[model samples]
Target chain A: MKVLATQTKSERTQAAILAAAEALFAKNGYERTTLRDIAALARIDPAMIIRYFDSKDALFARVATFDLMLPDLRTVERSAIGTTLVRHFLRVWEGERGNSGLAILLRSAASNEHAAKKLRELFKSQVMPALKYAGADAYAAERAGLVASQLLGLALCRYVLKLPPAVTMSREFIVAEVGKTIQRYVAGDE
Target chain B: MKVLATQTKSERTQAAILAAAEALFAKNGYERTTLRDIAALARIDPAMIIRYFDSKDALFARVATFDLMLPDLRTVERSAIGTTLVRHFLRVWEGERGNSGLAILLRSAASNEHAAKKLRELFKSQVMPALKYAGADAYAAERAGLVASQLLGLALCRYVLKLPPAVTMSREFIVAEVGKTIQRYVAGDE
Candidate 1:
């Protein structure tokens, strides 16, 4: 019982550190944010962060681990795939799951070379697989690039840049409009 | 003749400073780069930068003055406006004009609040007016936001992140595919 209690407390500390790091990274970006800032927010010793994550780079990697959690597109109706994907992304970015990881990655990717590399890897690993799974056979790579351009663009404008129209746009409207673009990229003929 | 020689030499110095500032800002971003670095690259005294541009903020603003140079779209056949705009942007980004100003702005905007605000203003002043001129009536603002999302996303993926597929896709292909989306945003019905 004593060991179990200690493990649970450690887990809570890890979670708190991660949460605080995500908030700071998302707000101030990677280079500007320091481990001390995270430690102060998490109410822990700065050394505790290094103990938990080894380094700032490791901690940021943990914070930026984004799983698209894309639904099995094969199961989604063919005609609805575009709308479905757009809807899923909107949820990933703004829905209950919270977008701190994505926000941190994107905000950092702009100026930090390492973060930019990680984002490129995420695009290859997560986005490419989804497109292939949905039967994008021949030009799958190109189509994935097209879809990414629209989706990432929307996220940048709405979430990061806070462009008024993109921020204020109704979720349904975005789904319909951007959905059409995604559909063309995914399923339309060249 | 003596006054003209002095004036010409000052103008040449100013142009050299601006060019060097643009290259450094595009390469190192806003925060990480220092006036010392700019001075070193421009081969001038650090105080000369202050004398010419006043401050780093002012220097960056001068470096990021991107004129989209979008032609009046009202004259083009409605179907071709999207293609024309995309083609123009391709030139602006990768063609003869060189994209240093745009690259500097976009690279900095990701992490800098001031640059982000300038991007929003550019979107409003440059992109919106072009769309309005193209007859994007009721949803002009929304359409402009959508257009900015795609174009900026393309720039981020292809230029900043250097995602392979986006970077490798042919200029004609990008114009064709992204143009269709632009057409829908600018002229298509809801």
Candidate 2:
């Protein structure tokens, strides 16, 4: 019973560390944010973070996991696939989940080599599979890349850089317009 | 003649500083690349950089100009506009000019606010005008934003992250495929 109690507390601490680390990493890009800052935000002792994570880099590796909870392509109507995907992504980014994992990955990928690797891994695992499922064949890999460029670019301009036009664009407008571009990228000629 | 000689020497110094700054900024990113490092690379006194540009921020502003010498939209065949733009961008990033200004901007924008601002300004001045010139009136701004996402995303993946699929794609393949997406973005219906 005592060991069980320790395990529950340890799990709680790990969850707290991950949540705090995500918020700090999202608000301040990787280089600027430190493990101490994450500990402070999580209201835990800094030693606890080091003990649990082993090191800042290791903690970041855990933090960089970008499971996007992407909707399976088989479930959506063929004609509405692009729009549905766009809407789903926007929902994930804007949802109560708050700062999305993809956002943090996007923010840090440019500056941190490890984060960049994770970002690429996320794209390969999460994004490419969906495109393949949606009927992309030999060129699915390339088509998925094109889609990434568009979607990632939008995230950079709209969320990260806060460019005026991108910032002001409504969700409906973005879904309709960017959705079309994504549709072409996924379904268009080779 | 005496004043002209002095001006020429000053211009040369400024050029050298800008060149060194761009290379360092691209390689190390913004936060890690400092004025002392830039001075060492340019083989100039650190004080000279301050005297000429006032601050590292000022030098960075001068260095962030992303002039692609974009072809006049009026001259290109209407049907081939997208391919032409994609080809031109690819050439600039991969050309004799060495590290493209856009590449540097992209590398730093994620971490530096000033760099992000410069990126937004570059897009506004360089990209939007081309879309307007191509006859996109009502939705030119939005179209430009969409186009920015795809091209910038390509730069991030191919140049910044070196994603395998993104890096290996041939120039012809990228231009043809990405061009179709851009064509639709700039000319497609709402």
Candidate 3:
């Protein structure tokens, strides 16, 4: 739920804790980041964190839940479905949020079990449903996996690995090129 | 050069160190893994690790040079190039080498600067050259980056993240399906 224009003090505290936790987890995977560190950054009492989210694990789950807010693919032209999905994700990754919540989950997954589980769950709950909802009834899971390969790979190289060529690609070029491949995975023949 | 059957005592020791180091680095990543851990696993004195390689960074560089041994894309049928590349990579990844050197490089890249630089260099020297040699000269670097997105994403999901669908995918099915996408990135019109 969007925080109302007049925010309650508790909700503001929760927001502060989440922002601090996400940045620390992103910078140093889950193992090295601690509640004390998060509390320090958030400027809240450590006990306040426990009262708000119960524990570090619970807070992590809350932080990791990301909605891609994919366009209703069923409403899009069947031929343009792939490009639309690509464009939407590009914006999500590059938006004012900078590294989206999903980026934190992915970056932390390499060394943290909780983050890895969160990553898989995010795919199952959020990504797969969107693909299936868009009319990829047959092999929807497989198709989503294929799409994940492309999208995650782009994120890794451009965002994490910071490979130069990938970092420099124009947004229009990435959408047109990556969209075609995703289009095939979503709607093209085997 | 392949180590000859007539290897000296020092050569044998160096080989043992590399094998142990690769396994440790692959499982624990570069930061959590230490020289002592590698030496214990290799049954060599820890000093020998420094004696042979001078430092963990140098030892890691030696272990991280993976050879994909891609087939000549120029020789491959233009229509079939993608599938062929996919099939070949599948073999390389699933080969007796178990976790390839690239896997270690990838796993370590997130937290280690040396590993990340080595990954970029590997792509520039090895993957980009092969793409250029295959007649992707016009957009070799960009094309290589696109291919890297698919291939690295597959490797991350299947090997590192161990995503169920990615891990369980039949070799033939992945080749047929992901290969189509790679083929597009490699030779398709921009």
Q: Which candidate number has the best DockQ?
A: 1
lDDT of 3 by residue, A1-190 (tens): 4646578989889889999988988788666889999999999999898777655655665575577777778799888988898889889999765645565556657545556777888888888877886544668788888888889889888887899889999889899999988888777663
Q: Is the docking of candidate 1 incorrect, acceptable, medium or high quality?
A: medium
For all predicted structures, in order, the TM-scores are 0.74, 0.73, 0.72
Tens-place lDDT digits, model 1, residues A1-190: 7764677778989988999999998789777899999999999999899777756765796676678888888898888889999999999988695446687678667656767888889998889988886754688899999999999989989988888899989999999999999998998753
True contacts kept of each: 0.73, 0.75, 0.56
Please give the TM-score that candidate 3 achieves against the real structure. Answer: 0.72
lDDT (Cα, 0-100) at B163 in candidate 1: 87
Each model's RMSD to truth, in Å?
Answer: 8.8, 8.1, 9.4
- Candidate 3 yields a Cα-based lDDT of 0.80
As a whole number from 0 to 100, the lDDT of residue B163 in candidate 3 is: 80
Clashing pairs in 3: none
Candidate numbers sorted by TM-score from highest down: 1, 2, 3
Model 1 ranges with Cα > 4 A deviation: A1-34, A37-63, B1-34, B37-63
Reference-based lDDT, each prediction: 0.83, 0.78, 0.80
Chain B structural similarity (TM-score) per candidate: 0.70, 0.69, 0.68
